[model samples]
Target: GQHAELDVMRKVEGVAISPRDTVLVDQGMMTGRAGIFAGGDVIGGLMTMTAATGHGKKAARAIDVWLSGGHYEGHEKSPPVDFDMLNLPLFLDAGRSQMSALPPEARSGFVEVVAGISDREARYEADRCLSCGNCFECDNCFAACPEQAVVKLGKGRKYTVDLDLCTGCAVCYDQCPCHAIEMVADVAALSAEAHRPLRFKARP
Candidate 1:
């Protein structure tokens, strides 16, 4: 038996080969089979449990979007937001609040060990939630725009640019995390369907 190798994947390998195994995937997990999604060790990227778990969630969302007459282009990654990106003057290193802990005697029981923070501490933590490569409606654009071209739509709505008023100054784009906004030919008139800036330009 030393000469023989265990081929557990033998049954499935070379069975559903499409676009020659390595070139068919549209995003990564998608195979040639319609409505079928894949992940885990079978997909062969990271091949780790954590990567597979992430793929599972990604594939689930992809399937949902495909069923709903749309496509999920995968999670849009942004530049890492570090301390240098933030206004350092605003952060005084006041230190983080401690979470309420349960004593050893209380831990002896089956009850939850960690207790919740106070209302004030909770609010303080909530306030610290930064926009950070994602828009949280900080209203910085509204306040910074001298031309008033950028309009805040408030809760449950998105910001809009009045092209008639907008001078393409890029102040709004510059203010609200350039990592979040892509500078296109026309800042306000970019294609809604454009999924991030494609590194390889599309051919005619």
Candidate 2:
């Protein structure tokens, strides 16, 4: 129910305020004044915890870049992962871990009701994540490739396919458990070689 004291900020030169009484910011969450930034509730629009957290993270990055005298281009956003994209067969069907809670009879004013899961239970629940479009480096594509085209680029670097060794087989694409590999026609090879060439797009 508390209101934002925007009147105080209005006195500052080059700071913009919207018609909705919210602070105005640019793509980098910066105000009209240089080195100044605002986000979350002050910026208005979607007023949720998740939105606020995202805003905070973005603003922090922008602030860091500004401090370093560099422009913040920001990280590219990936497409949303759909349920159908997940390899359901790879993950076991496990029920959600239930948290312990106090009984109705034990309930009291300002008392905690739900008790959170243990560290082991939390780890188990985390392991159940389908990972969807994100590759977990399961080595399925590496093993399934008949021509040994899939090349491991070490940990966190992901895999790359050797175009010379690849024979246009969709084995790597089919073996990818997370659906991270996409098969597209190599236009350059098709135009030059007069035959279709396999291009694997493995998103990191």
Candidate 3:
């Protein structure tokens, strides 16, 4: 059995104590009081270090918004990327980069045993991410298109297909490894609705 001592917190007015003996807060982690907020173990639920860290980050952002007289409007929630959505063939089989560590013979008391990886190694390891359902500009669709309808919009600007040049062959859709491209059928009208911008956010 565990208990949270709310003796000091009880002095604060407008705060509500839940039936479970935890602090009742809103979506922004704010309690009944206008400026007061609660998070971490005091708020209950999964009491883990990772959860506490996430709470701290969220609370900090909320506090910043409150200070600026603005409501904390978080980013639009998106569905989690599952393993099945990943295009495994597009990425090469590269092993994870391991941190440099001192040998057992060289180990000493109080001395750091593990060392941070080099910038190059860090970049290499980060690049290994699957980036599931998102396009990383692999240029597969551009190369696969028979009509050369795929227009290259350099760097961060994603590609767009020229509808006039496109023949509805669906070659670009098939070649897209990350499932970012989707096929929409409308033979009667091949207007703007037929095309979708290839933005950073992938289609669910």
Candidate 4:
């Protein structure tokens, strides 16, 4: 709380800010000086709890790698998902559930305004998630793959494609609601397409 102004500065002693901006971060979330990494509100851009959480995670990873004498190269930024990209049919049309609130009489002090939802309500709310841009491991790929190429690695681990068994039929890719699966053709597949015989129709 005391270092609130540090939230707006260009650099912090050993750290160097970008020439073009006040933000301090390189590929590995490293500041110019050794070992020190900065993120969160200090880095600017999206000023939200989600953005701060992401920064904290990235900074932690970078710090760990720095300690180990390695670098944590973060992923390249991709374009944000648009509403059109979402598979709306996969999500139920459920209205946002309001949190149970304390009665006006009980709101005199600094008590929390909203109470937690019931387990059933939580489940219902979770069911309404569109799961845009990220994989929620729905197992649609596991079921859709005729060759049984999709390996279920249990919750949080997600599924991996068994390339040997995957014929590149793209049934799994097509069936994926989140568009998480990608069909990457091998050199052999590409060469086969180049050499495939084109049939000529006989003149009637």
Candidate 5:
């Protein structure tokens, strides 16, 4: 029955089959060679609504391009609309809804099933994030450095240790409230791990 169905379908006009069927189908449909491209569970191995929509959109854009002699440059320069400004109620403090899972026995056969959070719940969870203080280097060590050897990197004011003036006094390490600074040996020798014992030699 399946062979007969295949033979009947193959006999349809404008059908072209090749050994590299996947590549040929994709190129033909996506490039607008046939004016339209479509396939489902039978023609394409993976059958999903998401994949079908993506293929359809690609084919539509290709057709538009061909009809316009490829002259249209779609959406060249428009500043991105700030999504935050959308201020949808979806962004407000509503928590997500819990989903119920299907039992193992009930989900034995092929079926489309999904568990997703409600919009309200998703927004409430997002509101819990702490957008707190400056993202770059913390200000604790910068404020505490007695020698003023640390340099402010930028407008956000992240600090970096200046090697030229640093005396390796370890004062910055001790004073930093946030513990952002640590004193290590100078740049000459880079060690992956700190040497356990300082190799001290008397200078003549």
Candidate 6:
């Protein structure tokens, strides 16, 4: 009975009556009927924080459009700010916080699975992040290079290594505190690769 109706219901839209007495609403958006929107777990699917936030934003925009006699675009027109430029302090390290698990005996039955870290412990963990100099550009090589070859392209421009006058001296690589800059070989000429072997055989 389950397999018979499930096969039929899969093809149908809106409402479907199955032999197993299961009621399926395939498209919830159509069921709202009033043209007002509704969504989330009640409609049935994976519900996450990100999805909920997005749905809320969509609903608010729709309401705004309806209230304005449908003339409004119902979308935020402001350009989003680049998060890298925001310079907000990261509250935690790049790694996930270690959660204290319930004991095996306790875990067998229903019990709170994870314990929270204390305020002091959380703060100590947050402090461990190596801020890695200024948010994007580390000024170490910029400060150290005597040739002054390294140029700040601006906030929009990622680092552009000027090979024309770079000389392949590797002074920039040496001075970088965060080890971001690497001394890559100049590939402009075939002669540059003469000594730098293309590939090496593994040891026998």
lDDT winner between 4 and 5, please give it: 4
TM-score of 3: 0.53
Q: At residue 141, what lDDT does model 6 achieve?
A: 60
TM-score of 5: 0.30
Compared with the true structure, the alpha-carbon lDDT of candidate 2 equals 0.83
Model 2: CA > 4 A from native: 1-25, 29-78, 193-196
Estimate, for each residue in 1-204, the C-alpha lDDT of model 4 and write its tens digit.
322245334435667665545456786667777777767666677767789788887788788888998878775554555677666676666898888898888896778888889898989887877766567878887898898878888888877766667676767766777656544436665667733122111111
After TM-score superposition, the amount by which residue 145's alpha carbon in candidate 6 deviates from its true location, in angstroms, is 27
Give candidate 1 misplaced runs (Cα > 4 Å).
1-64, 70-76, 90-94, 102-123, 173-204
Candidate 5: regions farther than 4 A off: 1-9, 12-14, 18-23, 26-33, 39-46, 69-90, 93-97, 101-204
lDDT string, candidate 1, 37-137, tens digits: 66666655665777979888788878888899887787756557665565444334556779878888768757878887899998887767654555666
Q: What is the TM-score of each candidate against the true structure?
A: 0.47, 0.69, 0.53, 0.65, 0.30, 0.33
* lDDT per residue as tens, model 5, 92-150: 35444567667767775676444566787678665553222212354545676666767
* lDDT (Cα, tens digit) per residue for candidate 3, span 1-204: 367788877888999998888898887888988999988888998977779787888888899999999988774544665777655676689998889899999998988999989999989987987766666788998899888888889987878878767777777766676676666664444456544323222353
Once superposed on the true structure, which residue ranges of model 3 sit more than 4 Å away at CA?
A: 1-80, 185-204
What TM-score does candidate 6 get on C-alpha atoms?
0.33
Q: Between prediction 3 and prediction 6, which has the larger lDDT?
A: 3
Candidate 2, residues 1-204: lDDT per residue as tens digits?
345678876988999998889889988899888888888778887877778788888989999999999988887665776888766676668889999999999999989899999999999898877777878888999999999999999998788889888877888888776788878888888889845486787764
Better of 2 and 4 by TM-score: 2
Stronger candidate by lDDT (2 vs 6): 2
- Please give the clash total of every predicted structure, in order: 0, 0, 0, 0, 3, 0
For candidate 1, the per-residue lDDT at 148 reads 88
Best by lDDT: 2
- Across 1-204, the per-residue lDDT of candidate 6 in tens digits comes to 112233443444544443444333222232223343444443334455556566566666666665666632444333333434232442333564687888777785566788888787788676554444322465656676666767777774635544444555566655554334544444444466544322111111
lDDT over C-alpha atoms for residue 167 of model 3: 70
